[model samples]
Target: MNSFEHDVAVQATNDDAQTTKVNAVERGYYEDPFVRYFARKGSRKSPLINRGTWVRVQAVYDSVDRFLEIYRESSCRQIVSLGSGFDSLYFQLQKKSLFREGDRFLDVDYDSVISKKVEIIRTNHELRTALRADLTQLTNTCGARTDQYVLAGVDLRVVEDLKRVAEKVAGFSLEAPTLVICELVLIYMEPKHSDAVLNYLSSSFTELLLFNFEQVGPEDPFGKQMTKNIEARGSPLMGLSAYPSAQSQKERFQKLNFNKVAAISMLEYYSKCAESLQDNVKLRIRVFLVLELIRMVKLVQEMLIQLFPMVAQVCKRI
Candidate 1:
C-alpha cells in the first residue's frame, strides 16, 4: 500500500461529505425532485456537471441493470457494488420488485456513507438490519436473504478490508456467476494502488465484472481544466501520471485474458432512450473508451522508457 498523508485523508473525508450531501438520484435522474427544484430556484442555467454528462450517467445505471439481468438468467442472483456512494439503486430496485426474495445484492463503502445508507434502509421495516451480519460468511444461513439483499459498509481501497468484506460474497459457489461493480472509483487512487484493486477483484471473481472508469485524454477540455483547478487548490490529485488512454485500458484487459471484449459508449445508450428526455435537454454521451477488467494489464516498462531519461537512453542503444 502507498503511504498516504494525513492531508489526503482529510481532504478525501471532506470531499466525501460534500458529495454524499448531493443525492445521486437528483444528479443522475432528470426527473428527480431535487433536480427540478434546483432548476427552478437556481440562477445557473445548468448544473456544474451538465445534463449531457448526466445522460452518460445513465450508462452506469444501464450497465448495472444489464449485469443483474444476465446474471439472473444464469441463476446467479448476487450483485456486489463496490464504492457505492449514495447510490439509491438498491432501494429503487427493491421498489421495482425486480429481484426475487432469494436474490442477494450488497453495497460496500466507507463507514460514514454506509451508516447513512443503513438509516435509509432501516426506515423500511423489512430492510432493517442490513449490516448486522458479517459479509465473509453471508451464505451460511446467518446471512441468507428472504425478501431483499443487503447494504454493507466496507472500504475497498484497503486490500484486507476488501478481502474481509468480499469473503461473504466469495464464499458462494464458483458456478454461481458473480457481477462485481467498480464504478467511477479507479481514478481516485494512484496507478499502483489501482493495480492492487484490479488484482484483488480479478482473483476474487471467476465470472463477470462490470467496471466503469474515465480516461484522461490529452485534448480533453474538462480534464485539462480540472487538472488546473486541482493545481490551483494547492493539491495535484487530479493530474494523472500517465494519460490513461482507451488503447492502454483495452491492452491491460486483454493481458488479463478477459474475452468478448466490447467497447460501449455512453452515446449509444442515450441515443436508444432519447425519446424519454426533454426537448431542451440534449442527451449527449461520449463513451470514447472501454476495456474488460479481467483482460487488462498495465506495462510499466513502456512507461519507464517514455518517462525516465536513463531508460530512454538505454532503449535508444538497442
Candidate 2:
C-alpha cells in the first residue's frame, strides 16, 4: 500500500483508541476489535488530535443522518465512501437506524487495503455475524459483496474503475439519491485526478450530496509544515494548491457543475456545532487548570482557523 493508504489505517487506529476512553466525544458504534491488532506501538493520539478527529466524524455523521431522513421517502438511496479505510461508518449507521435493509453502502479503497479489511471482517465473529456474511467465501478477493455493505478495491485516479466497481460490486444506480464522501482522500491525489473524480460524480449522479473534508489554507506556515511533514513520510498533498482556501474549495465544486455548494472551516464548526458537546470536552480535560483550559481552547481554535484548517463542503447536484 502507498503511504497515504497506510495513513488511513493509522487514523482508524487512533479513532478506535479514542472511542475506548471514558468520555469519548462520540461513542464509536462499531469500534472494531481488530484496530489494536493492526495499530503500531505508540499509536495512541493526544486529546487535541482525538478532538479534531471527533469533529470531522461528527460533521459527516450529522450530514448523512440528515440525508437519511429524506432518503426514507425516496425510492433508492446509496452512500459511496471514497478511500474508506477500515472506517466503521456503515456499521455505525446501521446501529443508529439510519441504514435501511435495501440501502447500499459502498466503501472503496486500494486492493491491498480492502483485502486486509475483508480478512479482518472474516476472522472477527462479531463483524461477520453482524453483516450476516459467509466467512468462508470472503477470502482471496479484493472485493466483498454482502447484503447491504459492498467493499471494493479501485484506483481512485481512474474514473472508469470507479464506474465499473459501482456497477459490478455495489450495484450503485446513477439515478439514486447518493451521498458521496471524500474524506481526506482527494488532497493526497493530483489536482487533475481529483478534478476528474469530482466532474465524473457531478455528471453521473442526478440527485447527489457530495461532502469533502480536507486541509485548507496551504499558504500559511502551518499548512506548509503539514504538507512537508506528509511529504517527508512519502505522501505529498498534491491537490492542496488547487483549492487552498475555503472559498476555493467551494468554487471548485461549483465549477465542477454542482448546483449548490457550501464550505465551512473547522473553526466555524467548533464555534457553532461544538457548543453542544463542550461538556464532554470539559470532562475529558478536567485535570487542567481553568486558565490552562481557556488558553488551550483558544490555541486549538486559532490553530484550526489559521494553520491546519479543515474545510467541510456540501455540494448538491440539481
TM-score (all chains, Cα) for each model = 0.64, 0.81
Q: Model 2: per-residue lDDT, tens digit, 1-318?
A: 675665564345333433433222322321334344333344444555555655566777767887788678886789999888776677667655677767899989888777777787777776666665563333333678776788888888888888878765578888788888887788878899889988888887778888788888766776777677766655667788887887888778788888777777777876686566557554544543332344366546645674223323333444
Off by over 4 Å in 2: 1-41, 135-141, 277-295, 306-318
> At residue 184, what lDDT does model 1 achieve?
51
Q: Alpha-carbon error at 204 in model 2, in Å?
A: 0.9
- lDDT score at residue 269, model 2, on the 0-100 scale: 76
Residue-wise C-alpha lDDT for candidate 1, range 53-115, written one tens digit per residue: 355455555666766776676655666777665565565565566666456677776666655
Instruction: Report the number of the highest-TM-score candidate.
Output: 2
Instruction: Please give the distance, in angstroms, between residue 315's alpha carbon in candidate 1 and its true position after superposition.
Output: 38
Off by over 4 Å in 1: 1-48, 123-148, 169-173, 230-239, 264-318
